[model samples]
Target chain A: MNRYSLNQATTKYWSLEDVVAASAKADLSWIGLWREPVQEYGVERSTKLVTDAGLRVSSLCRSGFFTSTDAAERQAKIEDNRRAIDEAAALGTDVLILVSGGLPSGSRDLDGARAMVRDGIAELAPYAQEAGVRLAIEPLHPMFCSDRCVVSSLGGALDLAEQFPVEQVGVVVDAYHLWWDADVYRQIERAGARICSYQVSDWVVPLPADTLLGRGMMGDGSIELRRLREACDAAGYDGPVEVEIFNQDLWNAPGQEVFDLALARYGEHVA
Target chain B: MNRYSLNQATTKYWSLEDVVAASAKADLSWIGLWREPVQEYGVERSTKLVTDAGLRVSSLCRSGFFTSTDAAERQAKIEDNRRAIDEAAALGTDVLILVSGGLPSGSRDLDGARAMVRDGIAELAPYAQEAGVRLAIEPLHPMFCSDRCVVSSLGGALDLAEQFPVEQVGVVVDAYHLWWDADVYRQIERAGARICSYQVSDWVVPLPADTLLGRGMMGDGSIELRRLREACDAAGYDGPVEVEIFNQDLWNAPGQEVFDLALARYGEHVA
Candidate 1:
């Protein structure tokens, strides 16, 4: 329980205040937050809410879609990521999750898009470091390779991160995005101190019509959640395990109900 | 054009006779086949039809689902694979593509499942070698890792193939399944003589309701078809290139039209 954290996105409909109250009440010491809702509730207010409730923010949800071919638009995205770093700093979290976005529209230049991601991170690393935040590169599943993130494997993410200092850039080993790789265990070991966040979500197939909502709770699908967590722990990641499932059904459920169930499953499957 | 082959599944609704006649009329010298349809057309009869039309069978579609835990069932599948080897030999094609199926029903032991695949191949290799057929492991995209093939990358497939004699085991580098990997080019080079087949298909996004039917015709989506084909050629694969699309839309289209379009796309995008 000490290491368990309910990423607010697990019950996405819950307000920041409601999630804070629920986490504190449930005796969970850690909570993961998203930028939109935190900003909506006012970052200062949201920060106060969590701190007052005696909970720590695990990580800020995301901020990196640097897939533009146009120079001005690219700079604009980098600026937005700068604001995300500010939010992460303001919220007192060291890790800011970065979802390197997919290929630019009307282009199939994957190498070009990846170069842009590397360049974008190099630009943001300084700002994030000054803000006392670590930019965590989250490699989305390969299905999203064309439309979501070109950094589709942990190796690929590490390739980008190795160009920076470990404190400036790291990786999020989310079970949903990485469980399929044969080299995951070895990569997890290589991740070592570079593992900024360890996220939990199962890969459920017959994925939803909107595939983004297809993540299942810890024990509901094919992932060996506990085994992966064990690997992360063995690789020196002792951070809070963020249960960040993106399921429509869980979102529709009562926030408390979803949180309680996630907590229980995290215990049974990921602990 | 001598290097181009129309995989029968691309025009799936076309009768074997129709496809053979079309290939002959179009001046194509090669055709790829699937087990079920060829069996239905009668393996010997189908072989006669192709040979009579002066069309060489490029490669046989598949045979491999060595994922069962039940002993009897596992042996049964092995026996079925032996039949597939016999069929491939009868059709006079050296390559028989294998889609190693997903984890067994309700099984999450990926290592154990992969072990079964290795053992299954070891058990079948001698028989395939004697029959003069090389078992070609086709690694589906990582999206199908759980329910289709755990062999999800060209590198992973090569890893498995390296365990066997190069003449007894090889791999399929389908552009659609492999285009997203950052290491694909390097892996293709590593494949060398182990490249049994080079399949062409585009990966269109906003995947359809039936994800299996989401493969696009060569130019319809994001894959760098010609680049991958060139990589295969540079890796010493001078064999016929198979166009094995699984799009439902293509199935509903006229067969000759689909064949003509696929051939044109091969010239435009994959040749």
Candidate 2:
């Protein structure tokens, strides 16, 4: 339970105050937060809510769609990322997740998009480090590579992260996004503490119409979650194991119920 | 035009005779065939139909759903694969594509699934080699990893392929399945002549209600088709550039028209 965390996305309808209260009441040591909700609730107020409730934020959901080809659009995204860094700092979390957006609209330049990711990280690394936050590059599944995030493998994320200081940047080993890779175990080992977070979600097939909300709760699908958690532990990551599902069904359930179910499943399948 | 191969699935409703006649009319040098349809039409009859029209079978669509954990089921798949190799030999195509089946139903043993693929390939290689057929393992997109093919990247397919004699086993580099991979070009380079066929398809987004049929015509999506085709050529794969797509919309279109469109797109995006 000490290392169990509920990423607010699993209970998407819940407010920041509600998530913090639920996590603290459930005796969970950590809660992962999204920037929008935190900002909407007022970062300072949200920060105080979690801190007062004796809960720590595991990571800030994200901010990094740097694949834009247009110079002005790219600069705007980077600017927003700067604000994300400040928000992460306010939330008292060292980790801020980054989802590198897909190929620019109508563009076939995948390599150029990946280069933008690398350049974006280089531009933001010092800023993140100065703010005492580590930007965690989250490699989404290859299915989402065309539109959501270009970094589709942990090894690919590490390729970019390795170019920065470990404290400044790292990779998030989210089992749902990465469990399919044959080289994932080796990449997780290589990630070490460069593994900023270990998020758990199962890959249930017949993905919903909105594939974004298709993530299943732990233990409900095909992932070998405990094995992944074990791999992370072996790689010297003893931090909180965040349960971050995005299923619409989970979102509709009561936040506390979702949190409780996630914790129980985490115990059964990932602890 | 000499290298253009019309993969039959792009015109799913077309008969083997129609595909052959269309390819002949289009002046395409090759036509890729599916095992079931060819078998239904009689392999010898289909072979003669294609050869009579001056269209060579670029490759046989597939075999090898050997991920079953059950012994009897596994053995059955291998025997079926043996027959597929014989059929490929009869049709006079050296490449018999393999889609390593997904994880066994309700089984979370992905590594075990991959092991089954490797072992199954090992078991069938001798027969394929005897038939003068090179088993080309096609790594489907990672989206299909759980229920379609365990092998999800060109590198992963090559890992299994390199374990066997290159002439007996090889990998298929399909643009739709592999374009998002950062290491695809490097893997293509490593694949060298082990690349048995260069399959092309475009990756369009907001995948249809049935994601399997979401592939777009080459010029309609984001994959860098010409770049990938060139990668294969650079890797010494000067084989037919097989234009294989699984779009439901394309399937419903007139076969000859689809063939013409595929040829045009092949020239514009893949040649």
Report backbone clashes per prediction.
1, 0
Give residue B105's error in model 2 in angstroms.
1.1
Provide TM-scores for the models: 0.99, 0.99
Q: Estimate, for each residue in B37-134, the C-alpha lDDT of model 1 and write its tens digit.
A: 99998999999999999999999988998888898988998999999999999999999999898988898888888888998999999999999999
Task: Chain B TM-score per candidate, please.
Answer: 0.99, 0.98
lDDT of all predictions:
0.92, 0.90
Off by over 4 Å in 1: none
- Please give the RMSD of candidate 1 to the true structure: 0.9
Writing each residue's lDDT as its tens digit, candidate 1 over A1-271 gives 9999999988898888888899999988999999999889999999899999999999998899999889999999999999999999999999999999888887888999999999999999998999999999999988999999999999899989999999899999999998988889999999999999899989888888788888998877889989999999999999989999888999999988998889888889888
Cα deviation of A183 in candidate 1 (Å)? 0.7
What is the Å distance of residue B36 in model 1 from its true position?
Answer: 0.9
- For every model in order, the fraction of real contacts preserved is 0.52, 0.68
Tens-digit per-residue lDDT, B82-144, candidate 2: 999999999999999999999999999999999999999999999889889999999999998
Error of 2 at A58 (Å): 0.5
Q: How well is candidate 1 docked (DockQ)?
A: 0.74
Error of 1 at B49 (Å): 0.3
